[model samples]
Target: MGSMAFSKGDRVVWNTPQGRTEGTVVERRTSDFQLDGQKFTASEEEPAYVVESASSSKRAAHKESTLTRRS
Candidate 1:
């Protein structure tokens, strides 16, 4: 991956099985943690983002590679 170019509250979009989903970056996960019983490993070099879905209002964690900054 490249560098961590996103910050909290940034609007971003990502692809899902249903379609493209838009959301706001809620947090940057730089350490390993568990969400909904699933374990996630994050680091300063390859951080994951916690985003809140615009439509569903649900939160999900995604790697930086899966997200795109919304314009």
Candidate 2:
């Protein structure tokens, strides 16, 4: 069986052009993708992670490589 380590609602940290920000996984797609704003797209090649900043409710997409699991 595959491990469902990260699913929707999971809190994670991802590196952005500005810096690392915290957010939540909003959706899961067969192909990774980014939501609104930002130019970068999300995919396994550049797996996308939807995160909402802890400081602000603002959300953004980030590459999985840039994201880290948070407790």
- Which candidate tops TM-score? 1
- Model 2 misplaced regions, further than 4 Å: 1-5, 16-20, 29-34, 44-46
Which window of 10 residues has the lowest lDDT sum in candidate 2? 37-46
**Candidate 1 RMSD computed on C-alpha atoms after optimal superposition onto the true structure:** 1.3
Per-residue alpha-carbon lDDT of candidate 1 for residues 7-69, written as tens digits (9 for 90 to 100): 999999999999999999999999998877888999989898999999999888999999999
lDDT for each residue of candidate 2 in 1-71, tens digit (9 for 90 to 100) = 12323578888877767886777876544464436744655454444556678878887665555667788
C-alpha lDDT of candidate 1 relative to the true structure: 0.92
Between which residue pairs do clashes occur in model 1? none
Clashing pairs in 2: 23-51, 23-52, 32-42, 43-47
What TM-score number comes out for model 1? 0.92
Mark the regions of model 1 whose C-alpha exceeds 4 Å error after superposition: 1-4
